[model samples]
Target chain A: MAEPRPAILIVEDEPEIRRFLRTAFGVEGYRVVESATGRRGSIDAGTHKPDLAIVDLALPDVDGIEVIRRIREWSPMPIIVLSARVQERSKIEALDAGANDYVTKPFGIGELLARVRAALRHAVRSPSGTSILRFGNTVVDLEKRTALRDEEEIRLTPIEFRLLAMLAKQLGMVVTHRHLLTVVWGPTHEKDTHYLRIYMKQLRDKLEIDPVRPRHLLTETGVGYRLVLDE
Target chain B: MVSIDKQRKPPAHPFSKIPAIFMGNLQRSWATVLRMNLKRHWVGYAWAVGAAAACTFVGLVMYPRFDLVNVAMVYLLAVVIIALRFSRGPAIAASVLFVAAFDFVFVPPRGTFTVDDIQYLLTFAIMLSVGLIISRLVKSVRRQAAAQAALEIEAETERIRSTLLASISHDLRTPLAVMAGASSSLAESGERLSAAERHALAKSVFDQAQEMSEHVAKVLQMTRLETGAIKVDRDWASLSEIVGAVLARLGERMAAHRVIVELPDDLPLVRVDATLIEQALGNLLENAAKHTPPATVVRVCAQRRGEEVIVTVQDYSAGLSDRDLERVFAKFHRGSVEGAGAGMGLGLAICRAIVRLHGGQTWAERVPGGGTAFRFTLPLEEAPSAPLELASN
Candidate 1:
């Protein structure tokens, strides 16, 4: 028998959103489970054990946060939060509560699917087992701690290399400011977030095709950074 | 001697102890006091009577060791106490009673209203006059205290009113200015601008208009809250669902930040006005997103402790200073955070109002790990036997 398509669970309160997401994910050949309430969502998450789950922060019966907490208790399955534009707190809560990624509501289907795929890939792959990270024409050799773009050596400062490597370590997942600051500048300098921004700008200037509007080295405002590896 | 004889005619009635002019003035003042609203001061009059009776009893007990003059001073002390504690009418009544008690009880011929010595008449006049003067002084002091209180209250109201006006104008002008500038640019540069440039300008206009509408909505909501027009419509709601709906509404705007929600699965249903609470939560989230740098984590977590559900929104930005945290909920009080958006600063104020209306307390604190955390608590009664469901659209 052909390998079973990965099961994905969607817990959104709105019927229209549930329908829209169902259609969008269905076309991508993943089996989808729908739950309209947070209560039902948690129950479905427990029963289905889907490879990935997309939860809405607002729910009629229970909060999407509850669903995230419940799933996180037992499973490491990637949970992608679907939220509204104003729910920055809920988005961060979902992320810190073990949600792997999030897509804000009214999101383009292309972007949602892209995040879903990234989350699912992160779930399936081991961390940095493969020594190389590539996005656009840039190649980062993790083992050698060296980077090349368009076949030319890209000189990166020590701080830039550490920042880039930290993001590359996660590949597609978000790395929080606290985590980055602690790792790069040590625990005492965690409050010095400006250092991260300055170095991130430098990294983008060197690595991105357009530094002004970076694609691969993305900054998640008020959160941290995520490095997108284009297939 | 003939001119002096005409003036001396007034002194013919030597038996009249008070001059005619003084007697006439006293009568006129008494008439004015009688015409005043005595019924409104009935309680003060009663208190004065009670005080006079108590003083008379004390004078009777102390008359053995203390001289008659000392006992009279006790009556004077009672008059002063009544004057300070009661209205002007009561004070006047107390003064009259003090003189009567002193003459009837303490004067020689102790139990009778007769005075054998004509010199004692002078003592009675002095005591009565002093009592009246003390009453007047006490009344003036009370009036001054009340006037000062009124002035302070008026000043406070004026300060708030002007602050509101300034904040509304500035907030309204910002978006209005943006809209006008963007639209005018499109109008003036249509021929020279490329299609993309035109689209961008148009987009900016639309965004500013949307922002202005949101501001107007906040302002209106605040007014309604201040006017006591909003009634809390308490219903059992799923915390997660309300949070989810807010997230859905704020969808694209929160795209950059990583949002984490950590509500427990077994959290009991909370009685709250869902719409208002949702708006409050939305404001907090928007505030966090606006104030923090891109990609910083914003977290929402709720814990059930006893009968309260404590919900917190935490952000890992440069944490708010102690001063900012204290004033964050004051209307139009914006933080001094750099790169913070041009908000009218009503978000936190509105959140506080909404939460307080729900009988909850809201507060902001620095997160231990480097960010600001806003927390609010809702009192929870009993969880519904069945899980509360969101109303279907």
Candidate 2:
């Protein structure tokens, strides 16, 4: 039997952007639900029950963050934010407000499609996330709290293990500094961003082939860190 | 005073920053003038009265030993000193005060407001005229300085406007023209072209659009940096992470160059706006890749020296000439080699601005082995103490 096509809800004010997005998503064999305003977007989110939502941060009717909040209130659907380069602060705000991923404006459709696919795949995966995260030759089993490279076992500090597990929970998506710090080091250490910098380097040095130019443990610049795992 | 003709003929591109240099001097002079005048406005009158009283005491003592003319000359000296040291108001007040005191205390009539000698009347006129003339000269000099500053700012604004217009027409118009032509052809006669030709046309449209978007972004970013609109959101950040992010962002752009990153494992974290630093580093790398030949090595390295971390991006290409090295960081300065790359020549300028905002310095030098090295220094701070954790391995 053919599987039901996944639906994608796009909340954007510009009809031209919507038209291109609709065409791109349509050509990719996904059902697209369009909303011209934030109010209608929140309404469509409940009615359509899409597998993913692409929300433009700057909307005409209401703030896009409000739409993300509204959808997150009732649904666990993956939401990808479309932000302009100028909206750096608000982009991070949207991501922290439960957005799964983001693609900056003037971005090619292929970038957006990859983010959408990652967010959608992340949605259908296990709630506890993949226990075994693999990148390059390094394999980390979060459930067992063991890291191995090739056939050799690698020692990971307790904080390193916890940081890996926190990043693993949001696999393939950006985990904000505040989120990672809060989860791994507790709420009191949320603002201690130096801890994240220190630990992320250690993690990268241990797992990445070239720690300076990491291929999997990615830094999203000002936003946070993203851990990409091999399928 | 500034002439209207200078406004019509804006300075050339080479001297574009002359106005900024002029503005620095203007600001410093204004600051010094303001600091001197801050407490001198209302207090100058008191100083005028005080000087007159002090001269009156000297005149009273001199009247008993010398001729009354010597006492009159002493009052005249007070007026000359006041005129030299103060504004017109204080100078005029000092002149009138000295004249009244001389007439009351020393002129034939002792301790009364009367002038018994007409020659002393000439002395009063001379004192008043000196005060007015000196103050007028001082005021003119100040006004001239102010007018000169305003003229420089106006000429600079005109220069920037023209340069911006010229850059827009040259950099943005090319890609826009290609995009318009290609898209129209695809729309008007898609079925007439072969599959590969159609794909190539569409791909060119996409590529041109992307290129134009980058140009527009650089223009906007330069504008924002110039206007002081971008605020640095600083936090503790790792330089390696920043470099990693830049390399990733410039993946395809740097693919032609053999990129090498040499950061130490124990490199301390820097407090900076990581996003801006990433852009700054990315621009430098992109510039190196754009100017250097393919397969040449481009190295990115950072070393801690004293309290600063010096980051260098070295490209093994033909080095810039001495003059080119000096002007490479200027806006709209393209590489000397033609057809090497196409950019609005704002990458290094923007990189300099971003680095400067973080209290860092950026410069380019000729590498020893026929290449250029673009280096910047970022000041380092003591790393924040992290919470101690057990290994529990």
Candidate 3:
């Protein structure tokens, strides 16, 4: 067990929230570096060079989006945002500003932990990610342009494959509608969310066991879509 | 000494009573302004003139067939009716106009303002007095009715305030008590308790905190909906997607009941704020889960009816009374069985408000086989054009 432990940087203004996060991350066998303001958070990101960073959007000195931008300028470290339920617009904005993921305020520590683990694992994986994705009995191979459900090949339109590939690229993290639409349907259709809705339903119908309560391809309500795969 | 103090209290110096003098003058000015406002009803004056003309015409016709005293009686009736219908200004105007017209047309002078009989002066005086007295009486009654209406509004405000306070103290205080007791126990006696016991206490604290947060969020959301702070960001969305998201959000809360969904495959895409619609549907599911007993079946169904889509959440429980069915959507209206963990009864109210903001209607009705159905409609819109992949591929 000579592997160096992963480090996490927490940028939050409230001392109470920071205290709990410290304890939670500590108990989970991760080293934590705390910053009380966004300015200090950006500085610490450059100094500590942590494997990942969890930043609160409501910072005292600067906007959390600013911190993410500064970090993006120099590092490709996984950045996850902590936002309140009221900050729905900024949550999407943070994602569009290069944030890898977000956890809403008043969230269970388990939910945050799962997100953190996924983001870190995604960072460690190949930059192109895995070509083959699996959801329950369904398997989709992006490179091969194939989808199978229970070993039977299911036909998917080219747009559906492209949408799946875009979601799979940010697998386990929220991919904003703007990001997916821009990448899959070109920049002209960035604001056309119905395309995503129609295609997502099509994908879910063909792949999911029960399309109504999907286990893998999930909708993020006003935010975006997240593609989760069984390990 | 007491007499001297009383004398001092009466303000020995004139300067000491300056504020009192000023207040009296201010009150008089306000009364004048109110009187000016009362006289601003020109329509009433017009009606008064019309009434006087009609009485004059009738009086002239009766000058040959009836007595002059009877014509004066007609003038008195016109004054009384005008006083009852309008303010003092119109009443006085009606009486004065009638007197001049009667003297000029029906009196000794056939077309002049000269009166030959002294008793005609008596008739004019009586008409003026009657007009003034009736207008004063009518004005006082109107003032009383306006005061009563204002008092009713104040009482309503007081009722809502008390209800809000009661709800906050009951719903929010319970969670506060649990969190305080549980956390204090863990802080003071963590070493003495077993691992499972400590875990249970911690979990209760967490669950209570979550419940408290939800209650607070609902209160805030209701206020935001009422204050016009919520902007409905409409987009092309599917009812099936919104329904699925709500079920997943209410995962464990609805787990106790046997939930069934019946949505048609060809359901059209609706243009609405998806997140708000999700919350609206979630509240219905939560209400159904809260009222019904465990293991009862709850059905979520949707159908396209004409230009709108009707979504229903039906629960197979003891149906609500006719009164409760209507009152359920009113703010702070609770059901008969308010078990522990019951909300402040704002879920349905919030649901109704959100649905209305989306140009939809919500209602509750009893199902035939002994259950309640909560239904709402979302107006449909023309579907957007889907992208073609042929040329791009």
**Top TM-score model:** 2
Model 2 Cα lDDT, one tens digit per residue, A1-231: 299999999999999999999999999999999999999999999998999999998898899999999999999999999997564688789988989889888888998998888788778884877788887898888888888999799988888888888777778888898898888889998889998888888788899998888888899988888888776
Q: What TM-score does chain B alone reach in each candidate, compared with the true chain B? A: 0.83, 0.81, 0.85
Q: Rank the models by DockQ, top first.
A: 2, 3, 1
* CAPRI-style docking class of model 3 based on DockQ: medium
Per-candidate fnat, comma-separated: 0.00, 0.95, 0.70
Per-residue lDDT of candidate 2, residues B173-254 (tens digit)? 8888998899899999999999998989999998888778878888899999999999999999999989989989888889
Docking class of 2: medium
Model 2 residue runs over 4 Å out of place are: A85-87, B1-40, B53-81, B335-342, B390-393
What is the CA-based DockQ of model 3?
A: 0.52
Q: Give the distance in Å from residue B342's predicted Cα in candidate 1 to where it truly belongs.
A: 4.4
Interface RMSD, candidates in the order listed: 18.4, 1.6, 1.9
lDDT of 3 by residue, B6-40 (tens): 46698778776777666667868877855675569
User: How does each model score on TM-score?
Assistant: 0.56, 0.88, 0.87
Is 1 or 2 the stronger prediction by TM-score? 2
Worst 10 residues of 1 chain A by lDDT: A192-201
